[model samples]
Target: MNKIYILLGTNLGDRFQQLNLARKQLETHVGAIIEASSIYETAAWGVEDQPAFLNQVVLVTSELQPLACLNLTQHIEQELGRIRFKKWGERVIDIDLLYFNQEIIDLPSLQIPHPYIAERRFTLEPLVEIAPGYIHPVYKKNNVYLLDKCTDDLPVKKISDDEPYRH
Candidate 1:
């Protein structure tokens, strides 16, 4: 089984509910959930004019390969009403394959070690929470190193402790 790390974000209706729904959907399509980070509320990263987003990171163990995982995630996003209107536009839910078993994937449609991982605090904060010592295959650095090197001045705050991580 491959240890996959996924990031979920939402800024649309019922943000918390959307996150929960995304988690459930991922568990169904991607694989069983192993670990999840607390929800982080963060300012819009690329397009600053939009609403703040709620983000979370999760670790899952899956038997599917990289492209199959990406296909399923995109399918889930569309099923939940995601329209790609802008580069970093607000959406009902966003699912990103952050890492795939310390493997590097750079296909046109999918990019593992999510290219922006080291640049966004929102992604890094929750990642650091659950997998601080996990190394990035491309950078050869751990989550802690990426968090420390992140230059995205945007604020990432943990808004919910009411919920525990997923199993």
Candidate 2:
């Protein structure tokens, strides 16, 4: 099985419920989830006028390839009521394929290593919680190191201390 790290966020409708539904869809279509981080609430990036987003990271084991996984995630997003009105626009759910087994990919349809891992505290925080030692193939840095080096000024607040990633 190929190990994949996914970052999930939602800012519209039932945010937490949307995240949970995405998790279920990921397990069904992509692979079984092995680990996830506690949810974090963060101010909107790109477009600052939008509402805050709830974010988390999940580690899964899947047999699907990179593009195939991307296809599945987009399908899940649409099924869950995502509409691309603008770049970084508000949405019901935003699922990002952060890393796929340490591979580096830059395709027109998808980009691995997420292109913004080093700059987004919302992505690095939850990622560090679950996989601090998982090295980035390109940067050759671990998740904890990346989190410490992140310079994104946006606040990423943990929803609660006791909450687990799983529903």
Candidate 3:
């Protein structure tokens, strides 16, 4: 089984609930979720006018290939009422394939070690929590290095008093 890292976020209704639903669906479609990072509340990226998002990273072991995983993630997003109206627009849920066993891929439908992995602090912060030493195949940098290089100044705070999916 290949270990894959997936990042999930939500800014719409019951954000925490949406994230939990995504995680549950992912476990069914993909494989066992080996690790999960603490949830972080962050300002929306790209579509900066939207609401802040609740984000988290999950490390999973799966038998599916990268494309398959991507497809599965999209399915879950759609099921959770995600609508791709604008780039990074607020949504019910967003699931992104962040990395797949240090593999480099650039295809029309998918990219491993997601192209924007180094640019988003929301993604990197949780990634550092779960897999700080995992290397990025293309950049050859670990999570720590990537976090250090990220230029996004969006604040990320861990909700210490809340449960993973409790709103």
lDDT against true structure, model 1? 0.92
Compute each candidate's TM-score over C-alphas: 0.97, 0.96, 0.94
Better of 1 and 2 by TM-score: 1
Q: Give the top-scoring candidate (TM-score).
A: 1
Q: Against the true structure, candidate 2 has what lDDT?
A: 0.93
- Could you tally the backbone clashes for each prediction? 0, 0, 0
Whole-model Cα lDDT per candidate? 0.92, 0.93, 0.88
Q: 125 in model 1: Cα distance from truth in Å?
A: 0.1
Q: Write the per-residue lDDT of candidate 1 for residues 21-95, one digit (tens) a residue.
A: 998998888899999999999999899999999999999999999999999999999999999998999999999
Shift in Å, residue 144, candidate 2? 1.2
lDDT string for model 3 (1-167, tens) is: 99989999999999888988998999899988888889999999888998999999998899999988888989989988999998889899999998898788989888786889899999999899889999888887798998998899989888732443321
The digit string of per-residue lDDT tens for model 2 on 54-104 reads: 999999899999999999999999999999999988999999999999899
Pairs of residues clashing in candidate 3: none
**What is the overall TM-score of model 3 with all chains considered together?**
0.94
